[model samples]
Target: MSALERRIEAMRLFGRLVATQEGREYLADNNHKSGQAVVVADYEELIKDVMPRIRSHKPPVTIALLKDDELLMFSIGPTPEAERVSSSAASPESTIGMLYEAACQTSNGSSFHLTSWDRDATAFSMPSVRELLSH
Candidate 1:
């Protein structure tokens, strides 16, 4: 498969997984365990917002995996604009975790990780994540 196809496949796999019962439970359990309320991001909006990047395919989008706001790993995020997740992300990290779980499964259980989708690969160098992603 092409890089774009691979990106789409991964996203679709993740979106499908998160829509399953097990996925919902996993998210709910994480929210319950956190004690602090977590807000679900409007992934649909995010997907729409990043559509231009996907179409041109000039700059490969990058997905960053961060734990407690620290960059852990990164790879190209090449999803197509047409195949967005059916629902908003369960948690900010859900997509990242799903992608990671499906693709990477790095050696660690979920504790605290952050995900940035469709951003420049160097997006995390800023003083704050809010600043990094804002660029």
Candidate 2:
């Protein structure tokens, strides 16, 4: 296989892993051990409300993940830029809900269980964690 194909497969595999319980456990362990900020936010209601209005925005909506204080855009998103520290998430159809949907489909109906921290430093709510794991 070609290098590009290999990379693509690797990314797909990474997404698949990240969507699983074992992947989550690994991430949680690394986060705790390294003191990294694994930001989680409650976008359930917020995304639902904003999605209708923002679905048609000029730029596509982008959802990023917080890994060790670095912002990595979801590889499955429209732009799919993974090497960046941060990028614009300007969107209409690019709402967090859309990302969640893609993540869901990618994970074969499993939950993303991951969330992004707000642009500003913010704490994730226990309620959000409960809701995420409960699902």
Candidate 3:
């Protein structure tokens, strides 16, 4: 197989692991060890309200995972909805982290019908301990 094919398969495997953990009770029990962000906001509700705005504005969005103070496993693309908003100005990291949380909630079915403009631009999906676990 070619390098690109291998990379594609790897991504699919990562997605599958995420999907499996996301849908199953076993994964739910294991979620505590994963160190996922303790989201304080009503992300589902927020995403629902903001998605249309994001799509319309087409602001740049970066999908990212925060590993300590550093960002790992990230991807960048346009978020059209963000373009419409009057953001006073926030750090790029803060903005991307917010977007990542929204995307995660949306993908997991907590928030329905609001798809990200660029789901493939993952800032952090590689070498994740949870993703590497044997199912």
Count steric clashes of candidate 1. Answer: 0
> Between which residue pairs do clashes occur in model 2?
54-92, 55-92, 55-93, 57-92, 60-91, 61-91, 61-94
Local error of candidate 2 at 36, Å?
Answer: 3.2
lDDT of 2 at 68: 26
State each model's CA lDDT, in order.
Answer: 0.33, 0.33, 0.34
Pick out the ten consecutive residues of candidate 1 with the lowest summed lDDT: 119-128
- Candidate 2 residues 7-125, lDDT tens each? 34434433553577765664454332222222222233244444343334332332333322222332221222343333434233344435544444432221222234222111111
lDDT of 1 by residue, 18-70 (tens): 46666445434432222222221122224333334433444323343333333
Ordered by lDDT, highest first, the candidates read: 3, 2, 1
Whole-model lDDT, model 2: 0.33
Highest TM-score against the true fold, candidate: 1
Q: Each candidate's TM vs. the true structure? A: 0.26, 0.24, 0.25
Q: Per-residue lDDT for 23-107 in model 3, tens only?
A: 2343344322243322211222234443444345333322223323222232223323533332222222234345544444432
The predictions' CA RMSDs to the true structure, in order, are 17.0, 16.3, 13.2
